[model samples]
Target: MSLTFDGTVLVPVADPDDGERTAAALAPYLSPSSTVLVVNVIEKAGGAPDKASVEQREEYAREIFERARGPLAERAGSVETAVLFGTDVVETIFEAAVDRNADAVVFEPREGRRFVELLTGDVARRLVKEARVPVVALPEDDG
Candidate 1:
């Protein structure tokens, strides 16, 4: 079945390049009124880990949003950005979608082998199955 993307689109971005990839994937489906919300979730850990501070993560998120905005500005009505802290990534994304009144949720699958997916449990797969709103997953670009 064919789908049309309008209104607000909630996009959860993990990697820096995910912004560009997601923008490219969703550009075709977007309309003049479409608003893309690029979200970066800092997976919260109980103890201190070898990761950037919250401020640093927020800065990185902004950078990702800036990169995405350049490509999507011409295609979509507007592009927004957010930085969230959560323990459960999927749940956080879904919550954001609901809060933002998103028409759809778009994301890219984590690039890895089947063994890795099996070990970590694919977040994209779980999101597709559990999301209340329409979910769009861009195919992994290995090249």
Candidate 2:
């Protein structure tokens, strides 16, 4: 199918390295007129004690955005970042897409072994299966 980047795109990243890699993968599809929304979800423990302070998590999210900003800025008209909080990562990503009025949810799938993916609930699989908006999984950049 043909993918257009004339509208806003929501990209959910796992960490700093993933942010950079995903940015590279997505850059080719974007234009100077496209708006890119980069997000990192900080998983909350539902009502239990949190793994880290909110401040710490927000700071890490900033790092993830920083890693991605340069590459995306080179191609997109604008690059924006958000730190989302939710018990469910996939759900939060979808919610952000809808809330931001994103044209599509685009990402570079994270790498993991089958066992690890199963144990971790396989977020990439769920993202493709559960997204309400169009989702694009771009191939990793060779460089």
Candidate 3:
């Protein structure tokens, strides 16, 4: 029997593997009722001398989301992307998912753009900690 999934899926993606793996895990389970919502949060205040202010952070997030559309869609079918400002990645994901009435969250277990710098602790875990909705976390194969 097929799982009766309703509403959108919240995918907190930072890289291609996150997108791809989320797609892979979701492929077998997803039905026509499923939709993917990708939330890419680019941290605003870096240790850099020039830290992004509130507006700048939001703008940067928007830009990142815009640039990522084609790539994400290629992996997970149609997706709605959003860039949000704040250090609380957990809160951001929770708010976005709940706001959109997402049935669950499918995500990758990594962060950052490069191989070595990726943060091992994923935002999805935080979602699991904070939100009651189901969160599916996928790790990319080393191969």
Best by lDDT: 2
The sequence of per-residue lDDT tens digits that candidate 1 reaches over residues 42-128 is 888757583778888888888888877776888888888888788788888999999889988898776788888777668878899
Candidates 1 and 3 compared: the better one by TM-score is 1
Error of 3 at 75 (Å): 10
lDDT of 1 at 92: 89
Off by over 4 Å in 2: none
Cα deviation at 78, candidate 2, in Å, is 0.5
Model 3 deviation from the true structure expressed as Cα RMSD, one decimal place: 5.2
- C-alpha TM-scores of all predictions: 0.87, 0.95, 0.61
lDDT of 3 at 44: 44
What's the true lDDT of residue 115 in model 1? 88
Candidate 3: regions farther than 4 A off: 1-4, 46-78, 111-122, 138-143
Steric collisions counted per model: 0, 0, 0
Residue 77 alpha-carbon offset, candidate 3, angstroms:
8.1
RMSD of each candidate relative to the true structure: 2.3, 1.3, 5.2
Error (Å) of candidate 2 at residue 45 is 0.4
Worst 10 residues of 1 by lDDT: 44-53
TM-score sort, best first:
2, 1, 3
